[model samples]
Target: MGNEKETPEERRERMRQRELSNPSSSGHGSNLSDLVGGLGWKGTGLLILLIITGFVVYSLATGN
Candidate 1:
């Protein structure tokens, strides 16, 4: 069975079933560190960029 090839839909359904059977394994209840770690370097960089942009916009709006 391990050697058998699964179609994309089949694989997706299998994964869905696995997640349903093990809710904790889906990472929905993970901590902040785990969530950030899962985002990888590029995602972390983009998040930092967004935060800096928001700060700049707020500062400009407040004229401070």
Candidate 2:
């Protein structure tokens, strides 16, 4: 989308071809690391914190 050399149609086609080539994965990579990696190292920490928070919340809520 940022390429100045390509027209809108070209961009659309390029995107279409990219999607066609990797139909199983979305732009976020369809994986936890890929999704968090886009946000850099902080995202990893945030994800871990979220997981821990969820576990703690669950444990507290269920007396587990």
Candidate 3:
């Protein structure tokens, strides 16, 4: 029977099982905050770049 139809409960159960199987890639966007701690190195680089850019702009504007 290739044209099988699943009931509502069956569909829900299937979705739950799929989520439990792959918890990391479950199409959830709520874990993006977890990336903040993981970006330690990148965050430091970004801060350095911002500071350098600000200094350059200030020096150029003030002729220092």
How would the candidate models be sorted by TM-score, starting from the highest?
Answer: 2, 1, 3
Candidate 1 positional error at 64, Å? 0.9
Candidate 1 structure quality by residue, lDDT tens digits, 1-64: 8526888889889999998799899657877777679999999889889999999999999999
lDDT of each: 0.87, 0.83, 0.77
Candidate 3 CA-lDDT value: 0.77
Which is the leading candidate under lDDT?
1
Cα TM-score per model: 0.50, 0.50, 0.39
Report the C-alpha lDDT of model 2 over 1-64, residue by residue, as the tens digit: 4598889999999988998798775746367655876878887788889999999999999998
For residues 1-63, write the lDDT of model 3, one tens digit per residue. 422687888888987898878876766755645565666978867867988999999999999
Instruction: Output the worst ten-in-a-row residue range by lDDT, candidate 2.
Output: 25-34
RMSD in Å for model 3: 9.4
Clashes of each: 0, 0, 0
Question: Could you tell me the lDDT of residue 60 within candidate 2?
Answer: 100
Whole-model lDDT, model 1: 0.87
- Give the candidates in order of lDDT, highest first: 1, 2, 3
Please list all clashing residue pairs in model 1, or write none if there are none. none
